[model samples]
Target: MDPILLTDKESSGAFWPVDGDSSLIFLGTGCSSAVPNARCLLQPSSPPCEVCMKSLSLPPEKNKNYRCNTSLLIDYCHGNRERSYILIDVGKTFREQVLRWFTYHQIPRVDSVILTHEHADAVLGLDDIRTVQPYSPTNDIEPTPVYLTQFAMESVAIKFPYLVNKNFKEGQEIRRVSQLDWRIIEGNSETPFASSGLQFIPLPVMHGEDYVCLGFLFGKRSRVAYISDVSRFPMSTEYVISKSGAGQLDLLILDTLYKNKPHNTHLCFPQTLDAVKRISPKRALLIGMTHEFDHDRDNKILAEWSEREGIWVQLAHDGLKISIDL
Candidate 1:
């Protein structure tokens, strides 16, 4: 397949295509509540948030500050003629995101999906996979494979019982369930999984007191690590990331939810900065921002910080795409 540039109004000159390489697209960059929160809009505070105010004023087409739930799309060439797409975390806005960013008619189907955790923002869009099953690129009618931890799988079954139970009572209509083949991942394990001709290593991290969230490392030559949500990382996981290429990383997408204050479950600005220093990636892009952050203003802050710290860092906006050759 030849290199094709994917562009939209917000990302017109920002994206460049590269052949025989892998590309990562940030479909959404908001937290669980999402930017322009309904409650925030309904109940105005003393000093209204300029970011939210600006987002409300601009039209949808021109607004770059409006964010949806966080998700990533990994694309790579499978062979001479086929292109493969692997989605990471299908959140609440998954359907709208695909509709807005992808030429759905041109693409055949998604290769696979990997879930990060059991959070509603991460797994609620599982049902939407049914839409793409009929258009399987490989012409296989088999179920779509979804990989997640054992705990996450159980949570899915509980949340969407209808999808798992195939036996229906008499006279009950057979609902068209999402064809899914669930794969269980063991905890605290770094297993190498293959999809769409690319290899990924699941890196486990701490998401609070009880939850364990996953991050992923893709490719061997042009290594990219994506950890969209994380409060802390275990020492072993840190070793695995730092062990690669003397701790040099081609790209690192991390979580930075707040500007100054820290959250128990998400990384704030100070924590994210410390993480960038420790990991020492060649380029770092911050994701999982809330409405409290103004894209243009916060980005300027990041630029100055990057210069002072001598590390490349920036904020990830919706529809942001980065290509890396392996």
Candidate 2:
């Protein structure tokens, strides 16, 4: 049987599920270097960054432990019983992350993909999603909807050239993936695609020093907002998400790339909180942690910090799944 979800109303732009609702799930919660210097950089000799140090100072979730970045597995069940889903973001440890989540419970198949940016921690694991296709044998065939802004698509193309073949045409417009000049593949056959029940809303966010990044507003509003790579939310983005807050917030997954020192690109905890207050979603979760963060400590402190603010905050672990109301 499908999991229990809240349902009754109908509308986009709110976190409150429709009267006949659906769901979403978390995949990972680490920074680009999900493993810290000791792992990815192969610089086990280097010291942990200040953010990681502060992370180690907090209490651990004591339940699940994901190294860094995390995403959601969303299932948007409409009032009429139509079901469609989206893969919010894929992380570095994504392969490991999904395997763990599957071990505990069966989840709705990942239908499409929504990206925050092109950072390794978020996009590298994307290759693993190829495996998802084979698992959901009943769904119709379509190129996985990889939703992102024009700028983000450019970054991914440069980084993962093979994924989006220079000759492929169907994927050019998946989610405003730039670098698509007219006539790139003039003679190639058009491979058409569409997501089952997922709508892609591309949100442009400010990252660092003049570089704007893509933060996706999943399921339009009521379901979830996966904004992990942003340092600050642009007015346009705030406007888009503000629209989603009209309903009760199920989950507001956001960036927490820094603990104290503000970053040139992602948000520090304080900035993230400020945005949360304005958005005023029912729940909020922080993601994009660095290796310096010891899952054993920071979570406790972060939770305490969240409480003082009177906001419901939780540290994202490697394999945690949050079933949202509609």
TM-score of each: 0.87, 0.68
lDDT of 1 by residue, 17-52 (tens): 344456677778888888787777899777876777
**Model 1: pairs clashing at backbone N, Cα or C within 3 Å:** none
Q: What's the TM for model 1? A: 0.87
| Per-residue error (Å), model 1, residue 273 | 0.6
What is the C-alpha local distance difference test score of candidate 1? 0.76
Instruction: Give the TM-score comparing model 2 with the true structure, all chains together.
Output: 0.68
Whole-model lDDT per candidate: 0.76, 0.58
At residue 242, give the lDDT of candidate 2.
66
In model 1, the runs with Cα more than 4 Å from the true position are 1-20, 59-62, 79-81, 103-108, 135-140, 243-246
